[model samples]
Target: MKIYSLSKIAIVLSVLLIFILLGALWRVSAVPQTSLIVQDEQFFEVKPGANMTSVLRELAEKEVIEPSFWQSVWIKSNPKLANIQQGWYQLSIGMTLLNFVQKLHVGHVVEHKITLVEGFTVWQWLEQMAATGDIIIDVSYDHDAFEYQFTPLSKHHQMTIREGYFAPDTYAYAHQAKASDILFAAYAKQRQQLKALMSEFTLPKFIHNEHELLTLASIVEKETGTAKERPIIAGVFLSRLAKNMRLQTDPTIIYGIGPSFNGDITYADLRAKTPYNTYRINGLTPTPIANPSLASIKAVLAPEQTDALYFVARGDGTHEFSKTLAAHNKAVKKYQLTKP
Candidate 1:
């Protein structure tokens, strides 16, 4: 009878112990494990091959997650949690521990952004990419990779890195994003943008194909500052092209001179026989001088119909368009020669 009584007591104690453990797990799981107050956002990286234990320890050390023995127990209970992906992660306030672990396991990481501005040269674009602190710029990678990657965009197989094929816009990427990834994104976006724009407008008589249209658009972009003036300036270039007149645009001369070009263009520079020198070469430059915006590209396809062939800057970030050389010379004297 004493033995029976002892067995009953032992059974009751075992049941009570199981209930106590279940209550503890429920309490820990419901309580907030982190009190991170994300203002803008929080960024962190998990190195390749980082295991869950080390990762959780680092997160606790950083105060991203509250350190708790129960939390470790919960995480270790699942064998699938072992496959944590390595990359940057953006964490925010009010995220549950369960949600965070799931995101890490699936490799959902934070994305970084870099903006490539309109009218930026290829070199300028590279500099912008390097300026973004998040990306890993591959110094040894050849910049000419664009040639093979975007062969159809080039007029010939000899397309150099200087060709303005990359579309100018803001781009987002994950951490450790390479320079090629950014460039290729820009290029791909530009191709899509150009293709869409092409379908919307009939190709102007002067623009024979996509390559020529982009070349003209780049010139129009460099020549004008005002967005409203793009179509008008495109008209002047088209008119010049129609009449077989020398483009006489100074930007082309500056482009030909390349890095050696000082702030100013000289008379000798105009006469210099470079492929990009519009004064020496009759048609468009061998390639685009800078990446043209979508608006500029659109303007080239649908130019403002006008007989005006000349424009002089009005010094107030505008230009005075004229129909004849005589009128052009007069405007140049007023705007250029009489500048204070």
Candidate 2:
């Protein structure tokens, strides 16, 4: 009778031990099964000072994971919950709980999606670049500094970073990246693209060097923002360049006046005697007014074969291209007239 009692007790204890082992194994298996969560295509920012519960709540709020209670329970049960790592994580939609935990434990942060669009002036880009956190491009870094450093390169037969010379692309970058490095990368990409396109073009007698072409492309980019108008604008500038006439691009005047120049181009701003003022310079500015798109670059390389020598904005994000001064004057009067 005593032996029988002993056997029953042993069996009960054995079953309890098995259950405990299974629970431990289950937790271990779950550590790697967390799914990635993405909300509205934005990565969650797991900043500093976020605790395990707060992180879970943030995940829940972002719709990357389920309700807070579930995550809270899971995190509490996990042995490695003390190692809640923080950074900008690129969580996907429908991420599992375990994978999410692992990501935090590993401290994986998503890079910033820095999109430098075409037609942004250097000063405008500098402001946007500064807005991103931990970026080191000081607003105090003078434009003259960049120009002075690059002028020597131009003398060495190398192209400098000028308007329309940087590639317009969405680049993935760390938050800690330097501003100068970002600008340099964009310029390098532009050079690579230019080299490939330059091989394709058989230029005429008038267009001699790469700088002249890039200068013309920058003017085309500034004259019209619409893609459809780029080619026609390029023709007008190319024609003007051929005739030794002033490009008279308004963007150049804005560039001359610096960041103080608002979008409004005043008559006095046009008459400004700065080197960047196309009205005064009678040709392309020493630097580009803004970063031109690839379409503008290609337009300069393969300009539309036309006799257009003038263009004026229609205030509708398009341009009126003309072959004669009379025709251009008529367009200006029709489009530039103010409605009281």
Candidate 3:
């Protein structure tokens, strides 16, 4: 009877030991091995006021970590989860648990990408800037207000960074970036590129200032998307400018209408009196209509030597170039008036 009692106690103790061992093993496996999160492509921004528990929740939600079990053990074992710092860090594969924890404690953060596509207006770019949420800037499509506010800056430096002055390109911004920082970055990039491009070509004879050059480049950008077409479009605008004829560019009319552009251009809208109405106002608009691409800038700086005075869209993504009003009317009739 005593031997039977000893065997029963021994079995119970052995089972208890096995359970304890398993628990230890599970905890060790739960601890992260790498500092990098392999789950999501975007940089996970752990905002201010986010605690260890909240961060763990985000990690689990993104499948970066194995949910709550490890966190529970970590909290129980560690003294207040240590001091986790906030910053960008590269996530590497196979980082060890203590190292990963140490990274959080050190708080090394990483930067993310913000891409600005070509042909985007200032208003459109502002919307994109606002969407980042990391940056603080008031987005306004108000033409008069924005133009008036930045006119001095544009005029003083002959800087094009006011309206269509910022180049459209992919930019990297830190998680803590602000709107002005992003805008300034783009403006700086344009300045560098413009300087380099200026070295390669002579400025147009009619353009006395850098602002005028940028204004013409912006018009070229709006008129055509094809790189080959930019020079031709530039030529047409140049010819009109020389003739003292109104630019009459539709994009300028669209800009004047602001957000009311309903994908339809009306005759009355074209004749509407506004500062940006190129049809009524001779030469380029009071300000650039949209940001010009580098290709358009190059086209303006070194335009094709042509007497072409007009062009109409060829229904395709191309344009029909002409040298006279008669030729322009013919092309317009064939391309715009004729039904497909």
Candidate 4:
């Protein structure tokens, strides 16, 4: 009789403990979580293939959430709603467990912005973009690697790094994005825009293909003294090309000198026989010196109607357009020589 009575008491005690545990779990589910002590600016990264259990354990250790095995159980019970997406998630205090789970499941990943400026070299562009520190730079900034990785605009197009193919604009990217991702995005946008614009305007005889047009646009982009002067500069370059005259643009010479070049450009640098020296070469540089803006690109396709074949910067951020070399020289003497 004593042994039977002891067994009944043990069963009752086990049932009571089970009820207590269930009640605790019910409170955890119904109540808002306050264990999170992480700052508003803090972010938790949920990597690919990460499970909720391990993530909850990690959060507990980090004090981002209270330690509870039942929370993971709660997640497992509702697998559909608890499925977290992979990316950076901003963590904050006073968030319920459901709120946390739903936020990750819905994929509210943090994003960063990068702006590629007009007339920036490919190297400059990459360096500036990498400043975000979350991007993966798998490929080096070179023609061989980029060409092999990305598809050409057309089968006839030769893929090159210095082709001025990537568009200049502010791009938004998630954390841990690849450098090639940004490159491909910019290239795709630029390619699409170029295609649409090409249909609107016809290339001159001197400009053979899209490559030549981009090359001219890059020159026009760099030579532009002001936003309003882009069309005029483009016209002047087109007139020079039509007249069989050398472009004689300074930006190309500076590009030929490479990154080691200081701000100053000497007569020797101008006379240098580099492939990019338009002053010495009879036509456009072998490749674009820098990326061009949309305005510059548009200006090249539909150049302003003007007889002006030359332009000289007038000390300030403006230029003096001249139809004759004598007038150009006079403006240069007035602007370049006499400026303090």
Relative to the unseen true structure, what is the C-alpha lDDT of residue 14 in candidate 4, on a scale of 0 to 100?
Answer: 99
Off by over 4 Å in 1: 1-42, 47-51, 57-72, 78-86, 91-102, 105-108, 139-162, 259-262
lDDT of each: 0.79, 0.70, 0.74, 0.79
Which residue pairs of candidate 1 clash?
A: none
- Residue-by-residue lDDT tens digits, candidate 4, 172-200: 98877776778778889999999999888
In model 4, the runs with Cα more than 4 Å from the true position are 1-22, 30-32, 61-63, 93-96, 142-160
lDDT of 2 by residue, 243-315 (tens): 8898888777776777676678887877778888888777677766677788888887777778888877887
Q: What is candidate 1's lDDT per residue for 186-296, written digit by digit as tens?
A: 889988987888778888987798888888899999998899999999999999999998888888877666656679988788778888789888989878878899889
The TM-score of predicted model 3 comes to 0.71
lDDT of 3 by residue, 1-340 (tens): 9999999999999999999989977765667543545743445666677767777777778777766566656755775556676665555665544655666776767666888777778777767877776655533345554451323222222333367768889988777565556667777888898899878877887776667888888888878956788887888888788889888888888877876689898988877888788888877776777788888888888888898888889877899888888999999999999966
lDDT of 3 at 198: 78
> Rank order by TM-score, top first?
4, 1, 3, 2
* Decoy 1 TM-score against native: 0.76
TM-score of every prediction relative to native:
0.76, 0.66, 0.71, 0.85
Candidate 2 vs candidate 3, lDDT winner: 3
The candidate, 2 or 4, that scores higher on TM-score is 4
Candidate number of the best TM-score: 4
